[model samples]
Target: MVLANIQQGEKESLRSYTNRFFAAAAEMEDVNPTVAIPNYRRGLISGDLSKSLQLVKPKSFPELMARASQFMLLEDTGNGAPDV
Candidate 1:
């Protein structure tokens, strides 16, 4: 729907759709630790940062920390260099 709205030159509609998607995401009551963290990350990258933070905050701090640590090594090689 977002892509369709964009293709149709409906910028306002696209924004509304994006906001709706974020709102729906926010209303999720529960989610898997592994899946939810990644879902939140994707939301952040896609302009739903508040929603991402919402998902992150309800999780155990240690779990969040573990995800953060894993994020740091997502593209690790023996070269000991940053992926990005």
Candidate 2:
């Protein structure tokens, strides 16, 4: 199976970009969670979402997902995004 190169699109929301990254990561045959977690973080657009995830310092893929979920929820509630 060929894996698509994942990237954050211009004007794409954090949640959408993360979802795409997660989907691509899931398709890989034998990805190490420890390594993949940092790659996932690197793939995020540079902003609050990315910084916040870095702060959490997730050690595994699942931990990253949990943190991303919380960040998305906070974004939904209008509390996570930085003011322009």
Candidate 3:
């Protein structure tokens, strides 16, 4: 399954990966949470989002996306902060 095999590129932003992921998912007839959940989690880079997902697994796809969205927001904001 293309969706199952999708991996976050080394330099890809969380936003970009999410867009790509959804695009692949859109082509599928139906996405099973059992597959989507693990695939999505597995595809994330080993960072805050990945760590969070590992620590507290999302029970559903919606829940997984919500957490990813939160981390994406944090990542975006963190990138804009001025380093002391």
Candidate 4:
């Protein structure tokens, strides 16, 4: 799937990559969370968000998004690396 190939740019911020990822996801029909979640995790650049997702897998797309949103906020506030 094309989405599977989506990757965060070298210098892209988490929020920017998340937005781009969703935009690509929205274009597809009946996206399987099983496939989408893995793709999302694989695409993330090495960081707190990526590490969190790897250690504690999200059961659903919403859960993944929630975690991503939290990490993105932390990144925006200059706390990209969470205590996790």
How many pairs of residues in model 3 come into backbone collision? 0
The residue-level lDDT of candidate 1 at 32 comes to 47
Each candidate structure's TM-score, on Cα atoms with residue i matched to residue i, is 0.24, 0.76, 0.84, 0.91
Better of 2 and 3 by lDDT: 3
Candidate 2: regions farther than 4 A off: 1-5, 81-84
Q: Between 2 and 4, whose TM-score is larger?
A: 4
lDDT by residue for model 4 (11-68), tens: 9989999998988999999999898999999998887888898999998988998899
What lDDT score goes with residue 12 in model 2?
77
* TM-score of predicted structure 1: 0.24
Q: Look at candidate 4 and give me any clashing residue pairs.
A: none
Per-candidate local distance difference test? 0.39, 0.72, 0.80, 0.88
Clashes within 3 Å, all models in order: 0, 0, 0, 0
Error of 3 at 9 (Å): 0.8
Give the candidate order by descending lDDT.
4, 3, 2, 1
Model 1, span 19-61: residue lDDT tens: 4544554566563455544443443333223343454553653
Best by TM-score: 4
lDDT of 3 by residue, 2-70 (tens): 887899999998989987897888789888877787888789888777777777888887887888788
Report the C-alpha displacement of residue 40, candidate 2, in angstroms: 1.2
